[model samples]
Target: MKLLWLQGLACGGNTQSFLCAENPSVSEVLEGFEILFAPSITWDRYEEEVVFHVLKEEVELDVFILEGAVGDTRRICRRDFEDVVRELAHRARYVIALGNCAVFGNIPARYSREVKGLQFRFEKRGGFLGEGFTSRAGYPVINLSGCPAHPSWLSYVLLKILNGKRLELDDLGRPKELYAHLTHHGCTRNEYFEWKVEAEELGRKEGCLFYYFGCRGPMTHSSCNRILWNGVNSKTRAGMPCVGCTEYDFPRENMFKTEHAMGVPEELPLGVSKRGYILISGIAKTFAPERLKKRLIDEG
Candidate 1:
């Protein structure tokens, strides 16, 4: 497969994440595909010409992966990146939006009036590529969404595509295998969450972040805990809130503080009703285990 990776309004965090893949190893994974152009890995400006040529249909484009938001032409340079993206997307056999910015116009779109994602802007469809756009394979943009998408998720999707397997994407175009489960699944803080124990501050290692720290693990769709970031830990495991980075409405207000209504969280877990959450939480808190309430470490 001939792969071309392009970047628009981005910080290059996704490229860094891809470089850190461990299970299959970055080199091993790259060996499988023919990399036509990747600006981050190679400091070559002329590669854009090759991409331009590919867009013109002079060469076959097996896969076209876009990172970052598709900014407006007026605000940018003489060349319109969105135009190039639209053209290349139609020519490629497969189109993959490699991060939240590319898939949902993430942080960049928050302030920019003209920036948009490849296929969707936040939850709304009709972005740079429009809602009707589809790759030659008859598939919409395969979104690997995150602040900086997990390396494993990118590799997994690529492997599946290379093997000629049909992907099952969610309503937002994310692979079901990576986005079906909540970030809370397989989390180490499940006990504390169930018992409504709140972590007053960061790095306490004994309480759930949901109650006070605004962890969105229970509501966000991600395999962060199950697959583990860097094959060892997730944001919640490392004492940080989930932040719902994978969701379209990421970077929500008051990230450190959970929004509540009458002392109850405004957003409960996926299927748990407000009344049901209150009922279960009350019972669980009343019978909380003594072991879980105390600090895991002994400072004395």
Candidate 2:
């Protein structure tokens, strides 16, 4: 299980989040895997000799992980990081894009054309790696997208790989085991959403954050709620809106305000029809069980 992790225009958030893994944790998972290199952890760019070996592909690798968008890291021993990533992809069996930046050419990509995701730039294919590119293992670049991808995501995939399992991937190259569920799945405010009870403000334990507060729980795909962050709570559980960090078009302009088409949400939940939503929302609101209207805590 030889692994090499590289970074480009990165914030290092994914590594930070990956360290928070409780289910097996980073150190535990790293046991079976030989870390040939990683920018923040096992390796740093200043180590010219190791970087040389990795770049030259002298050491055969099993997995190649890119932490941020593929950008000009500007002369890692007179070699561009983009060139390094493109070259390393050919040497490794499996290639993984470890965060939204690495998968979708996120925020940094907004500024420079040089910055691009491994296989996609936002909604479009053909990023740093073109549309037809695949790993030595014959798989496309697997994306584990998030502002900072959930630690469990990497840990889970690594465990599966270590166990020699045949993994399934979505069209966007994300692992099906992780991205199959919506952010709404198992959300604490689901009851409020079912009854069309929308939160009027940012922090409240009672209502759903979808309608007025711009929570993308309904439309965005992720297992955040199902796979709890830090093992206890999520954005909605703490009464903050789900900013839809997992989607292709994350960090939209109106992240905190719902975009509506004449009082109807512009983006309805995945597979939910607008007419049906209106009809259900109306009925649910009209007969909204008296219990839903009150605060969750009885402060008598």
Candidate 3:
């Protein structure tokens, strides 16, 4: 299981997230397999004197994980990253994209004129592994997307590989095991959502933050509430709005404001109809309880 982990124009938060893995000391767990190299832990660079065993000796790869956005400039390190990604991608049995930046070009690529995400830019949609960029080994690139992907998501993917289970990936190449559900699933504030109890304040414990605070739990994918972060809580459970970090166009303009042209959302569910959505929302709100509408002064 020789693996290579590479980073491009990244902030290294994913690295930190990987290092903080609690399910297993990720390093110790992965030690059962050989690691060809890692950017942060390895001392190799363009100027380094380490022997390129993989390139020179023809070392086959088991997995390749790419992080960060791939720049669009002709003179930038994007080429270097792309070269390594392509070379390793073609040679590896699997490729894993470990963040939103790599999956859909997160924040930097949002409004930037040039830089693009690993496999896509905003308007372009398809990224480095172009619309047709597929692995020579027959497996598609695995995308683990999140602004900062939850640690467990990474570990679970690696473990699944170790156990030889078939990973069910989505259209975007994300694992269905982790992203098949929305962040709102199993949220403690679900009752408020069902009752249409909008939270007027930022940290209210008794109301849903989606209707007013731009929480995208209704639209965004991920199991934040179902799995529970750090084993005890999640964004919605702790009174923080679900920022829709798992989605591609996260950190949109005036993020606090919901994406609505009038009173209806501009973006509906994955493929749901606007009319059906409005009808269900209307019915849900109509059955709202007065007690849920009333604000609770003491959470305790």
- TM-score winner between 2 and 3, please give it: 2
Cα shift from native, residue 259, model 2 (Å)? 1.5
lDDT of 1 by residue, 1-300 (tens): 888898888889999999999989877777778888886665655666676567555688889999999986322233577777777788889999999999999888999868989999999998888898889999999999999999999899889888899899999999998999999999999989988888867977879999889999999999999999888999899889999999999879999788899988988888999999889999998999888888889877
Which portions of model 1 show Cα errors greater than 4 Å? Answer: 43-45, 73-78
lDDT of 2 by residue, 88-195 (tens): 898888999999999998888888887889999999998888999989888899899998899999998888888888889998999999998989998989989999
lDDT of each: 0.87, 0.86, 0.75
> How do the residues 1-300 of candidate 3 rate in per-residue lDDT, one tens digit apiece?
877787766888898777767757777667667766666655455411222556556677788888887665222233354565567678888788888887888876864755566556643656777766666556567888887898889888888887787888887778999999999889988888877778878776788887767788878899888878777888888887888887777767666656676787676656669888789889888988888877667555
Task: For each candidate, give its TM-score against the true structure.
Answer: 0.95, 0.96, 0.86
Q: How far is candidate 3 from the true structure (C-alpha RMSD, Å)?
A: 3.2
| Pairs clashing within candidate 2 | none
Candidate closest to the true structure, highest lDDT: 1
TM-score, cand. 2 vs. native: 0.96
Task: Compare candidates 2 and 3 on lDDT and give the better one.
Answer: 2
